[model samples]
Target: MFFDGTLWRDDAMIREGLGQTTGARMGHMSMCGREGSIAAHQFVLGRKVYIHMNNTNPVLRGCMPDQVGAWVINRHYYQHSIPMTDAAYMSRVGDPALRRT
Candidate 1:
């Protein structure tokens, strides 16, 4: 699973993972988004695995979460967007309606 740690409380995690060596934080939608897309492509093509994104992740920028998730699914890769607020409900209840995408 890929965790978008951009908004994590710890700067060290972001710095080491998403920041440049100069300590510059990368753009969430531009840098990390592309990384996530590439990862999706690789995993879907190479390992034939599914990829799920947390609702908090800003991977697709302006696109609606459900639309992107549907597109990913169409490509034979599973991409589900789970909202942070309803994450507990999903994990415990497994409600299909709670899924955003």
Candidate 2:
């Protein structure tokens, strides 16, 4: 599993297996809308996912009508989709109403 320490690293694959350096904290997303975060998601490759997002993470807002939707619909690669409210995940995970027909 890759553990990227930078919030926006140029190339995460390079540091995928290397151990953390002396002082490295986890990455975080602080952009206002989802465009920037969504771009980062698309930049990565292979079985991607997100984690430890703040409640206000852009994914929560569903703001990037173009990019975020593209990721959810076409790419199927949720690179930065964590910190979701229980209801949001449940809605997608279990609720029939949330699924596409």
Candidate 3:
């Protein structure tokens, strides 16, 4: 597993308790669980795999030219879509009782 020791580096908790190695302390915890204690990385090692991804959108990390091209070709890759056709049909012919849906 990749141990990113710097993800929570210089965070508030580390500065407050651990004296601002950030989580740069000799023994710190994970950013989520223990609040940036470095020792947390110890458990992250070994056979287990840490995906090492953030909760944010991966696309924001800077997409490649080919990735953008493929996205243009296969628009469905982004499933976050609004069914305008269905909405229009409903607006014209749907029951008012079901409009609350």
Candidate 4:
């Protein structure tokens, strides 16, 4: 699936201090560099969302639009449950400093 000198990422090689690699051989993931590189300031905030997904993954895609909506609601409900569980644990905590936390 590779051709000589074609689709060569010269910038990546230069960034990695690797002169220039060409032809047939593919570069390793270590040399692939980071994804979504952007500067962050107070007014210009940026972050990375780490999610494990695959092209062939059948999650919610098989479901209807109504089913997807229901799934989202359920997901949100479950996410909110974490705070309730934490509050319940804090209520049962005998330590004042921990409770204050």
Candidate 5:
């Protein structure tokens, strides 16, 4: 699920750009212009739980956390899986060049 105003909002847009009807599933995805966008948070959490549950990696690695207090204080689910920094998580997932080796 992509947030409004993000580069690619949904699978239809992605499919149109790539000109393909079928492809790998982009589970629990989001892109926001600013940090802690509420829309982004909602999109990630509101989607089917199974998508996130099945993936081994941190689903919200690149996305920002909700409002400072709300994220931690309210006890939103999957809080533990959020990455400290996008760079660190991306590295752990492996660089594209490294993966090609």
Candidate 6:
């Protein structure tokens, strides 16, 4: 589950009971942003994956080699796994009548 926006993040409330609940083994959080926009404070608990995105945030300019520890598979990389043909992509973007029967 992805929890976005600052208003929704309740660390204590989330960790208070949900962390130890039955079948809840581990929780990981990833702050997907440019660079400076995604602060260290956001990733306070659990395993945090910081995604320094250039298009998403302007902070990516400040993200140095040290700040970015490793290269992880992002959404775009995984998206390639799903086969997309002209038929599928065109149908979604074009008029409904243009879609092949």
Candidate achieving the largest TM-score: 4
Q: Count of backbone clashes for each model?
A: 0, 0, 7, 0, 0, 0
Model-by-model lDDT, in order? 0.41, 0.41, 0.45, 0.42, 0.38, 0.38
lDDT of 4 by residue, 1-101 (tens): 11112122325444445545531244322212242112112234444321221112233347678966765675577567889999998999998998997
Per-residue alpha-carbon lDDT of candidate 2 for residues 22-88, written as tens digits (9 for 90 to 100): 1113334423235335454666678655533322233435556775554455323334344355446
Residue 69 displacement (Å), model 4: 1.3
The prediction achieving the highest lDDT against the true structure is 3
For 4-94, candidate 5 gives per-residue lDDT tens digits of 2222223433544553432224433333234323443654554522222211223333545663333345334444446546446667765
Error of 2 at 52 (Å): 0.7
* Residue pairs in collision within model 6: none
Q: Which runs in model 4 stand beyond 4 Å of their true positions?
A: 1-57
TM-score of 5: 0.19
Which clashing pairs does model 2 show? Answer: none
Candidate numbers sorted by TM-score from highest down:
4, 6, 2, 3, 1, 5
Better of 3 and 6 by TM-score: 6
Write down the TM-score for model 2: 0.24
Clashing pairs in 3: 21-24, 27-39, 28-37, 28-38, 28-39, 29-37, 29-38
lDDT tens per residue, model 3, 1-101: 53432234435344445344544354433444454434456466465322222223233248778855654544453233447666777788657888657
Candidate 1 local lDDT, 1-101, one digit each (tens): 34233332223334446543221244332123344434435544333322333233354457788977764574444323334546766667656666554
Worst 10 residues of 6 by lDDT: 1-10
